[model samples]
Target: MGSTVLDVVNLIIARVNAAWWWASSGSSGPMPL
Candidate 1:
């Protein structure tokens, strides 16, 4: 159970970082692009 939660948290962090990087790219309007 603890490991599962930790994995999920890591996944969420990766996704958020990717989205942030994309948004920082000026020409992008939003994420999911």
Candidate 2:
């Protein structure tokens, strides 16, 4: 049961990291005309 809870927490962290990465990368550069 503890293992399952740890797995869920890890998954949530991974998802949040991925989203933050995407947002940072998307805004780091300027738009092209």
Candidate 3:
């Protein structure tokens, strides 16, 4: 049960990081197709 909760937290963090990276990349330059 504890491990499952940790897994969920990690997934959320990864998603947030991906979103932040996408936003920063968009502002800095054109995105790839």
Candidate 4:
């Protein structure tokens, strides 16, 4: 089945949140945003 727009947005948001959390909690340095 094809993915919906909401699904795409949710995926993007999840990725951003994961990255933010990682940046804050990880020693990888500050977030790119």
**How high is the CA lDDT of each candidate model?**
0.78, 0.71, 0.73, 0.80
Name the 10 consecutive residues with the lowest summed lDDT in model 2. Answer: 24-33
RMSD of 3: 5.0
Which predicted model would earn the best lDDT?
4
CA deviation > 4 Å runs, candidate 3: 1-3, 27-33
All candidates: TM-score: 0.64, 0.68, 0.67, 0.69
lDDT of 3 by residue, 1-33 (tens): 467988999988988777788787775664322
Q: Which residue pairs collide, candidate 3?
A: none
Model 4 misplaced stretches (Cα beyond 4 Å): 28-33
Error of 1 at 14 (Å): 0.4
lDDT, candidate 2, 1-33, per-residue tens:
467988999988988777777677875653322
lDDT, model 4:
0.80
Query: How many backbone clashes are present in model 4?
Result: 0
Worst 10 residues of 3 by lDDT: 24-33
Roughly what TM-score does model 2 have, to 2 decimal places? 0.68
Cα-lDDT of candidate 2 = 0.71
Q: Rank the candidates by lDDT, best first.
A: 4, 1, 3, 2
Measured by TM-score, the strongest candidate is: 4
How far off is residue 31 in model 3, in Å? Answer: 10
